[model samples]
Target: MDSGQISIGQIRRSEHLPARIAAQLAAQITEGHLKPGERLPTEHSLSKTLGVSRSVVREAIAQLRNEGLVETRQGVGAFVSEKCARPIRIKDEELGDPQSFRALFQLRVPLEIEAAGLAALHHTAEDLARIDEALAGMTGAEKWTHQGVEADLLFHRAVAEATQNEYFAMFVGFIAERISHAIDAARARAVLEEIVEVTIAEHVVLRDAIASRDPKRARQAMRTHLLGAASRINLSLEEF
Candidate 1:
């Protein structure tokens, strides 16, 4: 692509613009449009060409650096890494689409299963109460409602928090927020009543297992709930 064709396009307020921009440039590197050791455009020039701020351009470059997609010298700008590229993260919006439901759940399963096991091993009385509060929020809410969705996210986050690992809490919070729309899309495709009912039962089982301090049961319960969610979304594991 030429400099003339470099616009990054209109960005949504809620989306992380720098991450989107970084993903775009990384694709260029992976696809060979940007050759290894070739200097990137100056941040100021990128800001002008992409119609984003200089800070956004800088952050995009920084993200690529962190991902090992690019390298920088103190006086020089960025260059594509000489090493073969790893698979880039699918953009959150893309992953959260109903069509990508299986992929989404596949990403969730391992992390959340470990989170559940740790929560079972580590949860205190207050942590248990927080989990129950989130459950109560869902119980009082109707299916497909915003309140219910938020409650559901909180339940997962509470479990992460119960693990007593700050990184787990942060990562779970990010995943929960990103997956909300996908979860809604899944519900839209299926029987909302059945989705709600089954979700409640699954959450209760997982929560009870955690509260009982059964790591094995907590892991199994979480796995069952996520797999069941994929089914509710009409996704087969084979799709992943």
Candidate 2:
């Protein structure tokens, strides 16, 4: 592998294309395959090499820059930052571990609980519409499919957005993205029809609470939904 030269096989097609690409390049940089101050392959070069669009490559590079892993100069391409102090992050692969998954859930619960409360207090009609749309998506999706998982994520994001706090939205989005694969895995293990029905019902309750503009009710509803999710995943929160 030439200095920042990635092969087509290195990239995977998914809804999170930019993130997946960023993770791959970040691994290379941290593993020393790409040296400090070395220029990354140009966006055009990376696009062709990885068989992805320039926009995808640009977004991946932007993520790296945000993490202090890369730098860019005007009229020049991006280069690995000399002092690449990568920020704290939960690697996607680590979520497969039960302990890591549980820890992530622990972190998620309080943030989302507050988010639900704030959303109830602050949500606009448009916010409610987004939540409803996501709910409808989940309600209509086929059992145990990625579509359902994505819709579930969107619903949480909608709630986060309804809080009208950008940081709340950002962190909630991050946590939701991290737990997505775990949710998918749990869905696979669960009894399909039962899980689908149960999960949808919980979301509906949460949505109604939010729509009703009752912060207390919304917080409780979110808590119940998250705990129910943990149970479906075979995790005992009592042990934590």
Question: Best candidate per TM-score, number?
Answer: 2
Each model's number of backbone clashes? 0, 0
TM-score of each: 0.60, 0.72
**Whole-model lDDT for model 1 versus the true structure?**
0.77
Give lDDT tens digits, candidate 1, residues 12-44.
656666667877887777777787887788887
Q: Candidate 2: which stretches are off by over 4 Å?
A: 1-8, 12-19, 25-87, 141-144, 238-240
Model 1, which residues run further than 4 Å from truth?
A: 1-92, 96-101, 238-240
Q: What digit string (tens of lDDT, one per residue) describes model 2 on residues 27-88?
A: 88878878888889888878877788998788678657655678779888898887534446
Assess candidate 1 and give its TM-score to the true structure: 0.60
**lDDT value for model 2:** 0.81
- For each candidate, the alpha-carbon lDDT, in order, equals 0.77, 0.81
Cα error, candidate 2, residue 97 (Å): 3.2
Any residue pairs clashing in model 2, and if so which? none
Clashes of 1: 0
